[model samples]
Target chain A: MIKLKANGRERVWFYAFLSPWIIGFLAFTIVPMLTSVYYSFYKIHVFNMNVVEPTFVGFKNFKYIFEDRLFLKSIGNTFTYAIIRVPVGIIVSLLVAVLLNRKMPGTKLFRTLIYLPAMIPIVGSTIVWRQLFSNDFSLLNFLIGNIGLGPVKWSSYDNAMGSVLLMSIWCGIGPSMIILLAALQNVPVSQMEAAELDGANAVQKFFHIVVPMLSPTLFYLLITGIIGALQAYAEMSLLQMPGDSTTTMTMVVVQNMYRMDGYGIGYSSAMSWFIFFVVGLITVVFFRVTNKFVYYEG
Target chain B: MLKTENKQKRALPLVRTKKTRKLIGDIVCFAVALILSCILIIPFLWMLICSVQPESSLIFMNPPVWPDPIRLVNYKEVFFEIEMPLLFKNTMIIVVSNMVIGIAASISVAYAFARNRTREKNIFFSVLLATMMLPWVVTLVPQYIIYNKINWLGTMLPLIAPSIGGSAFFIFMFRQFLMAIPKDLDEAALIDGCGRLGILIRILLPQCMPIIATMIIFSFNGSWSDYVGPSIYLTDPDQYTLSIGLSKYLVANSVTPWHRVMAGCVLFSLPMIVVIFTCQKAFTRGIVASGLKV
Candidate 1:
């Protein structure tokens, strides 16, 4: 009888402790999530007195999204950005991590310097990058001009994505580099010594042993990077890069929802759902494929 | 003795040659590190230089590399011309409230997950993890509509209120940190007539100082830098955060003063840079722990 009462009390405590998250989950997350899905299927109208009546429109919002040229263009831009940014970002960060991992004088200072950019606010950093890439008075162009190259219009449609990618890589490389550096430190020194004894060159040792050991961290970074790239918004908006070519899906969605004419909430909700679906699919596919390659040290 | 001396001399030369090669490698490493560091540092340096220079210098065909008689006038303009003080106050209000509510809720829930063992707990934990994977954009429009309907459209409540529910990422991070604490501590507290909340408050929270600090820094930084959230909800000039306020410099007019914009950027980034430098070890540990283990 005493044991039963104690067990009952424990359950009560567990529930009590979990109450906040449970409430939050229900109100903010679960309800909002369901509402988004529902909104996606409806034509939501806000009356002058701020009354919201969502009428069931079935697949109309989805169909409109499909037909929307801006939406399609944003999707194309987003994909292109992700494809170029993710792999390149991973490689650059990994290389920097390796360089910083070296046991040398001033390595700590160098790491700190490298990570300073990541600490800057995204909006602030984007502003800085915009100035750096400005065509009229670009420091980058000035330096290149000295080398006899013509000035590049970095914020132009042709170079806008590239400039954004460059800034993203600079800001992003820090955390990934830090994580990879930690993973590199965790790699067994004895294994490297043994490889050296067996006459393995530095490149061979790095690729064959170190890379395998660090694959888990690498995989983690890759997944997160993809998700982050897909959600790219602040930089694009802050940079104010010209034309439809620079508009990401998130940017387009935000623009559509916040339009002064009326609430495009339903359509925007539909687009967000589509993005969520794509992200989910990509995550599923990545995990399925990478499970074969990601090494978890025993 | 002579033959032994000869062998020693021969071995010494090989050792010296190997040391030379190692020295060369170190030099190369140093060079690369220096170059990369310069690449990382130059942008901020450039911003600093540009912020102090006259607007005319920026417009010149060959812009002056160094500011002539560095002026503090642009920073003065940023403060006097712009609503910087109001923006700072608004940001602080949002950041402080969010941190307090967020940390309290996350600690409670994470403690429950860490200390309790039940089938439902396991299921809920998985649900929480799944929620982390769901993009914020998925919740963006719906949440906005809900907030708008509730008449929170022009208020900071939209930013501050949701954080009261606890963030999934922070909760997950706290849960991981709490799990690493030995269960024996919680059991001991329980035996001493402490309830679960008592154990969380008396036992776990004190040990979670590092994570708490990390959360504070992250929450502050996030709220400070958040442009999209503020831009979406706050339309009033008086209610704008630093981010939205600073962004105005870009879209203001054709003759936007780059110097003042750079000045705003410097001031905007200063706090975060200071925080990073001061609590760098904690910052790094938090990042590595959250990134790798999660």
Candidate 2:
């Protein structure tokens, strides 16, 4: 990556030009990131004078996180949510992209329609989703009941996460599909024709040619999607059934941010680290597993 | 086989089957795509419908597909129930601040990386891209504490101040776009005694309308729809953006006045819809471009 050809004047100009990003990055990204890591290991008490006196207790906060039922439960719920939602969302998006990639009528309109919901603010849509998913008052159950099915309790404990999962998938399908559609456009038409001439059907052609060709885009979506899913906050916060039923890993940390008591600072920081590590681990594993099969173009 | 082949030549039969298969495949795909798109878009449709429904008919035990009486008064009622102008004024403050400052900073940094040739620049560029993947949760707490420490809480500073540094995504985007521009212009600008900033401003920027529009749309929608930052920092109701206001509006009320809140919700996302559709090409390009970096 070295390109050390610029003269001293260019060096000065480079520094001059990048001052805003450098300062902002150091202030916003670097300092807080390190401070949070520091906070995670210590019991930080904020006193009246804006003085933070932290008492170091190495791994105690993390220990407490492992033992805390709420934390464990929240982590479990997050894993379960993402484990289901990520793959389903990806496959659904890929299928939609593949289908839409075919020459069909009104394909243009369908693309826009699918993508419109993704543009709506999650906070606003969650409000609408909450009201719409209420068991008796829901449009979903009402539509189902009209189709000769029993009204599913969308807000019940067993189904609350399911409803959010459904919504998450719904909101997610657009962007991923859009990405996959673009990637599909890049798939070699000659390769597709070769497979077709060899007597490959649509399903076989999709599984063999298209999936591998689109794997890099799919992997990108997977990592980002999982990262996003793990950071699920606003929707889980606002849309959960009226209780602590749907605390995600984010809420595990965020709940403490609201508490007036002081112990929460360290705990919240520790939980965030836990989320951070989980995200890193998942990214590594995904990259390793996908590296064997995914295609990357120059 | 012989009888069927007799109806048409063997070659003709093969072509018919192939054509029929493709026709069936297209039909099936059309149906599935239509259905999936409908399912995906139904909630926003419901929200739009609810915005016009009367208070009692917003969500129905037996929804009749359309609201009865279509009380467009709900739109006006939104203002009386909540401080619409104050919320909009507040939200637009963050959006415009982030848009103007964020775009400028990102473009400058991008230009620095694009034009500069240094090992450090290369390393910093990679770091910037990596930061794009770093989930905000890792920094959420310390940043909050920092904001609290700096007394930036209860104001829009926490929401607004971060953008002055530039965003990684936009910087990467601007850098990618800037790198694609031929260097002959920069060389000519240099020969003509244009300053570094002068070159970027005069020679490069006007050609970057698409990425700028993309950033503007993203920044506007991002800050406008943002609830988390404002929820964390802005404690005062007087400073609430519409998104935070919408989230709190439900809890702060008895039944949530769904019709009116739906009106608020519609207004909340109306600007986003307009911005996205108007700049549909850039919007999709941003998404596709950002996603393909892997």
The best candidate in terms of DockQ = 2
Q: Any idea what lDDT model 2 has?
A: 0.72
Question: Which residue pairs does candidate 1 place in steric collision?
Answer: none
Write candidate 1's Cα lDDT for B102-176 as tens digits. 888988888788777665888887677557555565566567778877899989998888876687766765665
lDDT of 2 by residue, B1-294 (tens): 869754554457687867876887788888888888787787888778878887644454355447777889988878767878888889888898888899899999999987887558977875674565444655666687788778887988888888988987668556655654547767877999989999888777765665576576667767777877888888888888888887787778766676777788888877776764565343232332332334
CA lDDT, candidate 1, residue A84: 89
Q: For candidate 2, write residues A222-284 as lDDT tens digits.
A: 766776776676556556565645433344335444233555667677777777777767766
Worst 10 residues of 2 chain A by lDDT: A251-260
DockQ each:
0.31, 0.32
Error of 1 at B160 (Å): 3.2
Candidate closest to the true structure, highest lDDT: 2
